[model samples]
Target: MQLPLFPLNLYLLPGGISKLRIFEPRYVRLVKLAMASDDGFGLCMEVNDNICHFGTRVIITDFDQMPDGFLGITIRAMDKFVINHQWQEEDGLRFAQTSVLPNWTPTEIKYIDRDLSQGLQMLFDEYPEHAAYYPQPDFEDMAWVCQRWLEILPLGTEQKQWFMSRNDHRAALSFLHSIIDEELKDK
Candidate 1:
């Protein structure tokens, strides 16, 4: 399916929330269209001045027009998709033909180990405000939690991209555990 592209430097994981300030004229139009459409728009990553092949289909949840002529909006991540082809129109808006990937059964990870869970728990405990948003450590929700952390954490763009490309929850959970351990150690 052909869809409009909104490329950003940030990563947007599934089930995550992204707030965007839409000041650019093209993006303003994009937001309007997304609000009117059912499928919404694609949020792609820009790597080395090129749009990444994978992106998430996002749904606009909140929108308000600011006095500065920018739109303050929040969007929820819905699904992962791949850009099949891309082209630019004369008006400077990017258009892409995309294909949604079939949802994969997230590999189950054992987060029940008291030691592992405690380590993860401590990490979440450090940020009490974010604790509510943290999912219970389990096989089904672990990947989603890791992906959300990867998106919101102060990680490099390359690392974020790697996490997005990964579909296996077990692998993602393991990677996240290692990264979190390393970060905690450094601090």
Candidate 2:
């Protein structure tokens, strides 16, 4: 499928919601087009002025005119996609030919996954603003938890892309465990 591309230095996986402030004329046009059509836009990572190979296929769930005079839109990721080809329009808006990537299967969060779950809970508790995005989080689903972690973690885009390319959640889960465990050790 083809999608309008919105490049940013952020990662949003399936089931994740993100608020974007659209100020540029090109992205404002992108938002307007997405609102009119059922197909949403592609949120791709822009590194060194280059678009990454992977992106999340997201739809605009909500929109509001912010007090700052920018368009604020809340987008929820529906799926992952691999960008096969992309080009910019005369207005600087980018369009991509993308193929949907399968999401990781939902796995039950076992006892071993508690640390990651609890750490996420702590994050939500500490940041009510962030918590507001997810009124009811799925802490029991390993894939959900790991994807959220992947979004919030300070990992490099290359590392995040590596995790997103995996066929399952095992590798991301193990990596999260190591990262969270190391943080706990420091405390």
Candidate with top TM-score is 2
- Candidate 1 residue spans exceeding 4 A from truth: 103-140, 183-187
Question: What lDDT does model 1 reach?
Answer: 0.72
Worst 10 contiguous positions by lDDT, candidate 2: 160-169
The digit string of per-residue lDDT tens for model 1 on 101-185 reads 6443544445442334455567667876655543444424555556655676787767666666666556666766687678779
The reply for model 2, stretches above 4 Å from the true place, is: none
lDDT of 2 by residue, 1-187 (tens): 9999999987999999989999999999999889888889999997799999989999999999999999999999999999999999999999999999999899998997888888889999999999899998999899999999899989998998888778788999999888878988998
Error of 2 at 24 (Å): 1.6
Residue pairs with backbone atoms closer than 3 Å in model 2 (clashes): none
Candidate no. 2 TM-score? 0.95
Residue 162 lDDT in candidate 2: 84
lDDT for predicted candidate 2 compared with the true structure: 0.91
